[model samples]
Target: MAFQTTKQTISQPLLDTAASLYCSASPHPTLKSISDQLKSQGHLDITPLKVRRLLITAGVYKSELASQIQSLYDSGKTITEIMGIMHLSRTSVHSYLPYVINADDEETEEENLCQRPISLEQQKRCEQAMEQFQKDWKGESLWEVITAFAGCTFVTSKGLKFTYEVKQNRHGEPTNELVISRKEKTVTKATVIKAYEKLLELSAEDSEDGITADQAKESVPPRFPIPLSGPKKLGTFGASYLYPIFIKLGLITEYPMLSYFHLPFSDDIV
Candidate 1:
C-alpha cells in the first residue's frame, strides 16, 4: 500500500496515470480535475478521454480490469457488487456497464457479492518474492522448500501432503517460494536441516550448551520439549523458546506456529 503514493508533490506522475485511466472505467469530477492539473503542469492541453484511451492501449496500466468486468458479468455479478470491491462509487463503475455486459450474461444467476480480483501490484510483489527466494536457495528440490514458507496446504501428485506460499507474475507465471521468514515461518525441508545442524552443534558443545537432547520422553520430533506447567494461550511460552530455535535453524515444518494448537487459526482469516 505504501507504494501507492500521496498526491501532493511533483512525483504526481502516478496520480496522473490513475486519473488518465479513468476513461476505461467512467469519468469523475475528482478524477477529471486531477488529470487536467497534471497535464497543465507539463504546459500541454490534453483531453481526459484521450489520456484514458492511452492507458487502455498501453503504458503500464492493469491488464485485468476489463477481464474482471467480463468475468463478473458472466457470473451475473451486478454493477453494484463490482463497484463495492473496487472501492469505486456506483456512478463511476456503471458508466462502462452498457459496453461490456451481455444480455445472456445478465440473465445468469448472480451472487450478491464478489471478491475483487487480486490487484496487479500484489501480483508483482509475489513474483519478486519468488525470484529472490530462488536466487538465495541452493537446494535441488525447490518446491518443497517454498511450499513450507507460506503456511499453506499442498497435496502432491501421489497424495503426499505439504504446504507453501504461492505467488504469480503479470504474465501469469507462478512462483512457489518457501517462507524462511523469522516472522512468517512457513518453511521446512533443507532450511530445517541447516537449522537442525546449528542447534545440534550448539547442544553437543562442551561449553555452555543451550539445548540438551534428552531421550524420548514423548513422541514429538524435536525430542527436547521444554516443560512449562500451566494452561497455554495463543503464542504461549511453549511456542516462544521452541519456535524461535526451530525457525532460526530453518527446520520448522509447520506453516503457521499456531497450527500446532487443537483449534487452527484459519477461522480468524476472512
Candidate 2:
C-alpha cells in the first residue's frame, strides 16, 4: 500500500491567534511554542514544522526585520535612515525590504559601501537656509501649501542659497525629501483653486492668527493618505516644514500662474 499525505484545514481563528502571538508577544514565540500553545488551546495534532508552513502559506509569517524595514520605508524614512536606525549595512537593509529600493551603483560598490557623513560646513549651510526659511515664514500651514505646489523648484532654490542642496544625495527626488506631495491624479488646477479658496475662508474666520496646518488638512483632506507622525510633525495634513525653502525659491513668482483668482502669499501666510 502507498502512503498518503493528509491536508490539514486550519481555522481562521487559529490563524488570527497565531498572528497575534507572532506580533504581540514579547521576544516572539518560536514555531514549536506556537504549535504547543495551539495544541493546548484545542488545536490538536499539529506539528511545529506544519505550523510554520501553514503560517507561511497564510502570508502572516514574514521575517520580523523585513516587516520593520518595509514599515520604515512606507513612513517616509530614507534607506540611509533605516540602516542607521537598524544598525545594519545598506545591502542588508535592501535585502530585507519587501520591495526593491532604487539604489545608485555607488551605494552597492564594495569600495564605496559606506556613505560619507555630511561635513560641518555643509550642515551649517543647510541650517542657515532653514533659519532663513523660518524668518521668512512664521506660520506652518500656509507655508506647507506653497511648498507642495513648488516642489523641486523650492528644494533647488534652497540649494542655490547655500550653493548645495539640503539633501545632497536626494537632490532631484522631491518626493523623497522633507515634503508631502500629492499622488498622481489627485491634484489638479481646480483642486488647487479649491484648496486656496478654503484657506481663504479659514483665514477670514480667524484673521488675527490665521488657520493652522491641521485646520487646513481637516477642511480639505487630500485624496492620498498622509502618514501620521505626530501633532507637531509636518506632512500630517498636507503641511510641511519646507515652507521657507519654497519662499526662498521664489514661489511668489509662480503665484500669478497658479490660479487666475487673486491668491496673495502675504495675505494667506504671515
Candidate 1's residue-wise lDDT over 1-270, tens digit each? 111212212123543454454534442334345456557677254444333323333343333444554465565434543443343445434322322223432212222111223355554553554455345432232333333334323232233334334444578665533443234444334443443333333333422424343322112333222211211211222233233323222333222221123321111101
Cα lDDT tens digits for candidate 2, 79-189: 544554555555555545432112321112111111233345544544454455445432344333333323222222222211112121445643323322323212233
For each candidate in turn, the TM-score is 0.19, 0.22
Q: What's the TM for model 2?
A: 0.22
- RMSD (CA, angstroms), candidate 2: 19.8
Q: How many residue pairs clash in each candidate?
A: 13, 0
Residue 128 displacement in candidate 2 (angstroms): 83
| TM value for model 1 | 0.19
lDDT of 1 at 234: 14
